[model samples]
Target: MSEPSRIAALVVAAGRGARAGAGDPKQYRLVGGESVLGRVLALLGAHEAIDRILVVTHPDDGDFYARTTTALAPAAREKLLAPVQGAATRQGSVAAGLARLADGAAPEIVLVHDAARPFLTPDLVSRAIAAAQAHGAAIPGISVVDTIKRVDETGRVVETPPRATLRAVQTPQAFRFAPLAEAHRTAVAAGRDDFTDDGALMEWAGHPVVVFAGEAGNVKLTHPQDFAATGGPETRMITRLATGFDVHAFTVGDHVWLGGVRIPHTRGVLAHSDGDVVLHALTDALLGALAEGDIGTHFPPSDPQWKSASSDRFLAFAAERVRARGGIIDLLDATILAEAPKVGPHREAMREAIARAADIPVSRVSIKATTTEKLGFTGRGEGIAAQAAATIRLPEEDA
Candidate 1:
C-alpha cells in the first residue's frame, strides 16, 4: 500500500461582505457568542482527515485574524499555516492560498471552504473527503425543493427549469490538489475570472465533478437578518461548573497580583508568572469546565517564555476556548486566602480586572477574601491561596 494521501483545507475569508452590513466583515461577526470564522475553524481543525489548514484573509484584517485565533485551542492553532493576503476577487484569494500551500510539500487533496459557513459537521467533511479521493473533484449540494424560474432583465419569464434537477451547492468543496491548482492557473491565464466557485472553475476546465449530499444546517451567514434568525450571540446553552485552587508561598517582591490587579503587599508570591493566584485559579477553573487541560498543560513553568508572563493571557485564552466551543462564561467566583494587604479595598477593582481578562461583564465576576482563622500556611502569612469556581454555558450538543 502507498502512503496515506495528505489532505488540507483552505478557508477563504478575505471578502469584505459589505452586503451583510456594518461593523466588521460577516466572517468576523459573532454568531452564538463566537466569531463565524472561529466556529468554522474549530470544526475544520477538529476534523481527523485534514492534515493542514490555511486561511486567506484581507490585507487590512491582520489584527482581526490575530484576535480570532485567540478562540482556538493551542493544539488547533498549531495546524494553521501562516495566513496569506488575499486579492480583490474570490478566485484570486483562493489562488493566493493555493500558492501558500504549494510553497510547502503540496498535499494530495484540498478542501476549499467558506469561512461564513460555521455549521459544517464531521459527517459532511468525511463525505467530501471520501468523494474527492474517489472522484477527481466533488462538491456538496442540496437538492432544490422549490419551483425553479428563469427570467430576463425585463422580468419576462424565459424558462422554468425542473426543480428535481437543481441542487444548491455548499462548500468544503473537495478536489485533487494538482488539478484544482492547474484549473486556477488556467483561468488566470485565460483572463476568465467570472467563475464564482472553485467547482465551477473546474467544470470550465473540463474536469469531471461529482456532487455529494449537502447539509441544510450548513448555511452561510449572508445578511443582518441571518444573524438575528440564528439567535445572534445568545443561543440555548448547557451550563457547567468547575472549581480550581492554587497556593503560592510569599517571596521577595513588595507587591502581589490577584485577579490581574496589583495589590501592594509586604511580600510577593513565588511563581513563574506574575503570581496572580486569583487569575491562575480562575483560568484553571475555566479550562477545567472545557476539559481542555490545566494551566500548567497550556503554559508550563519550565518554559522560559511563560516565566513572569501576565496571568491575564492565561485567563483570556481559557475564555476564548469556551467561546470556540460555542460556550460562554456565565459566572466566576474566586476567594483569596491571605492575611495581608486587605482585599476589601481592592475587591471591585479585582472583579473588574478579571472581567476584562475573561471578556465578561464585571457583574458576572465575584471576588472575595477571607482568613483561615490562623490555621494553614495562608493564615500564618507565609503564602497566599486562591480558590475559584466557574460556571460556563455551552451548546447542549457539545455536552
Candidate 2:
C-alpha cells in the first residue's frame, strides 16, 4: 500500500506588527501568560493530524524566537523545523516557508497559519484539513454579522453588499501541496506578489477554493487594545475568587522556602514537599477557585511521587488546570505571617518566582509580610503561616 499522505503546518510570523505598538512583534508578546507564537505552536503540535511544523521569522528575530519558544513542551519543540528568514512582504515570507518545505520531503497537504491567531483550536484544524482533502483547497470563514459597504476613492459608499452572503476569512487556510507550490512559483515568476492571501493567489492561478466554518473565538491579536479585549484576565466576563491558608512548623534547618524563593533562616519547615507556605496557600487558592480539591488532595504525602517535590510544581499544575478549563488567573495576593527571615528583603523576587511558576505577569501577583506582634507561633518564630486569595475568570456556560 502507498504511504499515507502527510500533512504539515506553515506559520508565517515575520510581520513587524507595528500597529500593535511597542515592544516585540505582537507574535512574541505574552497573551494569557504565554507568547502568541508559542501558543499557536503548542496548539498545532498538540493536533494529531499535523505531521510537521515550520516557522518563518524575520532575520533579526532569531534571539527573540529562541527566548519565546523556551516555554514550549518538549514534544512541541520536537515537531518544529529550524525557522527560516523571511522577506519584506508577508507574501514573500510565506513563499520562503514553502520553498523550505519543498526542499525536504514535501507534505501532501499544507495548512498556512498566522502566528497572531493564538486561539486556533484542534477542532478548527481538523475541519480545515478535512475540507482541503475533499475539495483540494479550503479556507475557514465566519458569516459577517454587520453590513459591509464598498467605497470609492472619494469615500462615497458605492454599494452595500448582502450581509447574509458575506463572510470574514481567517487563516490556517489548507491546500494541496503540489498545486499551491506551483501557484506560488508562478506568482513570483510573474512579479505578482501583491496578492493579499494564498487563497487569492490560488484563485488567480485558476484553482477552486472552498470555505469552511471558522471559530469566532480564534481572534488575531492586532492593535494593543486587542490583547485586553479578547477574554484576557483584565476583561473576562466571568470572575471567581477563593482564599487559602497554610502553616509549616519550624525544624532544625538553616533556610526556608517561601513562594518558590529560598530565604536564609535559623530554622526550616518539616514537610513532604519543599514546604513553601506561600506557594502552598496560593495553590490551594487556585484549586478552590476551580472548585477542585486542595494541594494535598492532588499530591498526597502518601504518594512517593510528591516526596520532597518543589512547591512551585504544585502551583504550576494548578495554573495549568485553570487554563485547561478556559480560564485566566486574574490576580493573586498573599500575606506571609513570619517574624524571622524578613520577607521585605525578597518581596519582588518572591512575586517574580510565583508569577513565573503560575505563568502570569508579576503585576498580577502581590506578596506582603506581617509579624503578628510576637503573640502567636509565627511571632515566636516557631513556624511560618501564609494566606492567599486568587481571582480567576472562566467562560460562562449556558445552563
Report lDDT per candidate.
0.88, 0.88
> For this target, which candidate reaches the highest TM-score against the unseen true structure?
1
- What is candidate 2's lDDT per residue for 138-222, written digit by digit as tens? 9999998888999999999999999988889999999999999999999999999898788889999999999899999888899
- Candidate 1 residues 1-399, lDDT tens each? 534439999999999988888889889987776789987887787677787899999989988899888656544576799999999899999999998998868899999999989889989999999999999899999998798889999999999998888999999999999999999999999998788899999999999999999999889889888887875544556789999998899999889998888888889889998988899999999999998889999999999999999999999999989877878787899998988779998999888788767766576889889999988888888999999999998876685
What are the TM-scores, per candidate, against the unseen true structure?
0.66, 0.64
- Backbone atom clashes (below 3 Å) for every candidate: 0, 0
Give the runs in model 2 whose Cα sits over 4 Å from its true position: 1-5, 231-291, 294-320, 325-399
TM-score (C-alpha) between model 1 and the true structure: 0.66
Instruction: Give the lDDT of residue 354 in candidate 1.
Output: 82
